[model samples]
Target: MASFPTETHRFQSFDGVELAWTEMGPGNEGARPVVLIHGYFSTAEVNWIKYGHAAKLATKGLRVIMPDLRGHGQSAKPHDPASYPRDVLMQDGLALIAHLGLADYDLGGYSLGARTIVRMLANGAAPRRVVLAGMGLDGLTHTQGRGRYFHRVLTNLGSFERGTPEWLTEAFLKTTKGDPEALLRILDTFVDTPRDAIAAIAQPTLVVSGVEDFDNGQAHEVADLIPNGTYREIPGNHMSAVTRPELGDAIADFLAA
Candidate 1:
């Protein structure tokens, strides 16, 4: 069994939206920070902290910051899709980085968070190193496709406790609290980056994927693209993959390398 610190705090993005984020580990003396971004519909504390990841990484002598993206966790939910654009997400991330005055750090993201990292790197906000789990830039194509697609699929699937696993359903319920129409509009605004985005990321990158869930073969493609990229496969489906401790170990090792 694993547990995490309950301490919580709030920060604001450039747009004035109040964002909720959690920081764990020691006071981060001279250690480079590791920013962890979660997938859509998931919060920082529940996703990353519950698995003892923050504590584990902290013990490894690193600082960790996990933030709840807009419309998730305790952050403000803006009804405007324009506000949630991919660049906006990137800015939100960089804003956190700049606010903390961290000159250099490592970055990691799962699912939607990974996609955001891709956008961040594409926009020239590259970190020293990056670890992307449960996603690849290729999946961003779907994100760029009609945002209405997410609205259609999710709305049509409306609250299916059956067939869907308990944990995933629970995860969905947390971030879908906004007006469905608003979320749809927001998602619609997202346009996935073309292959050029991957080509632009010059940092050392590590791509991780689960046994299940293959989205556009982006993970492998990403590994093949970056000058210094490596690929690793973890056991379990997309939802269960990142929650495992072994996955954290692999990430810690990669960052150390």
Candidate 2:
């Protein structure tokens, strides 16, 4: 029945951009923490906290470090497209780990956050474990259609009629209070870890997907990329699955293993 209080902190990223982090769990100095990266247009609150992901991890005596990726939450939202360098999100996570002086940890993310984790591994990170949710093998290549859809929504925000995909997505983005222009740039600069690189990450991994969400391609294929990886399916689609206790539980169980 124990619960940890939320503590927020800001650390300067390598690029000098200050990013925000929400830390939870007993602040045990020796505990190897878990870093939860959120999807695009998502904050620490949405992707981790509100959905009870952090809480579940906290109850297991695991520290949860949830950072609001720059341009998404309370982090700096530079409106200029050119300001977001390629691999900036991955850089933020790596910078945070270094700033905390963590020698070992588990890392995971959903959607865009998962893609960043892949890049982190491709860049030589060797986390104790990784949870890749709402992403698939197709993540290793261009998500052109996905990017184009978000682009169209951002550029033609008001043009879509109610109940349409663009309209609904715009509404969701507004709910997160993310800057459309900043998010557009995020999409602009997003890229995948090369196929060869993804296949080479040998760390233990869990690839979780919703029963109805296969938009990113084959989940099994993504799992196959990791020599020690496995895949699991939960109840909902990309967005709805975030709130399911199953999602959090699955991640917790994997990291604990």
Candidate 3:
């Protein structure tokens, strides 16, 4: 539960849309840089900073870069359909790396953020190391399944019953103060990444997920897809896993190794 100092900055993405990103850990030039993207419907604060993951990574002498993905946090949330083209999140991530002039760095993300990492890799964004947390082969290959589920959740926000998966997602969305219209557009931005592209990823990758998190399919199967991928399981389900210190520990260990 330790709190770490963080700095927030904004930059224009590929489409001139202003996006916000936060930085934590050592500021010195020698500190290794790692870009950590948050999950869908969650901001950098809720996903990384709020749960002490950023702090944990920072303590290990890493410069953690966490971006509040478009339509999620402090970034621009345009409801216009045109604002969210296919694979927009991946483009924004690539743009962020270019804007920062990161020639060599690491990348990590959870859930939707993990999906974004896969998209970035497929689209030729090369980071030295990568961590795809809370994702699986099915999640990457069957993007429409999860997208359709989220689309339903957003379109019928108040109709879900208590304790249901949709209700939990909606509750989390409410807590994040997410814009439904904008998020619906984000859902439209998703496109399936072929298994061959995933198989071609050459970076050392870690496929870590919660033991109970089957929401995105089997994590080990994702590890099997990548050319140089490893699988690790942490405590908690999809919703609770990110909050656990083991998640940060696993990521830091992998990155440090």
Specify the highest-TM-score model's number: 3
Model 3 residue 52 CA deviation (Å) reads: 0.9
Off by over 4 Å in 1: 1-6, 145-149, 157-161, 164-171, 174-182, 216-218
TM-scores of the candidates are: 0.86, 0.96, 0.97
Q: Write out the backbone clash pairs for model 2.
A: none
Residue 171 of model 2 has an lDDT of 84
Residue lDDT tens for model 2, 24-52 = 98788766699999987789999998878
- Model 3 TM-score, all chains together: 0.97
User: Could you tell me which 10 consecutive residues in candidate 3 have the lowest summed lDDT?
Assistant: 1-10
Comparing 1 with 2 on lDDT, the higher-scoring candidate is 2
Candidate topping lDDT: 3
Scored against the true structure, residue 63 in model 3 reaches a CA lDDT of: 94
Off by over 4 Å in 2: none
Q: Stretches of candidate 3 above 4 Å error?
A: 1-3
* Range of the 10 consecutive residues with the lowest summed lDDT in candidate 2: 136-145
Worst 10 residues of 1 by lDDT: 176-185
Instruction: Compose the digit string of candidate 3's lDDT tens values, residues 1-257.
Output: 34568999999999999999999987788998999999999999999888788888888889999999999899999988888999999999999999999988999999999999999999989999999999978899999888889888998979999999999999999999999999999988998999899999999999999999998889999998888999999998999999998998899899988
Sort the predicted structures by lDDT, highest score first. Answer: 3, 2, 1
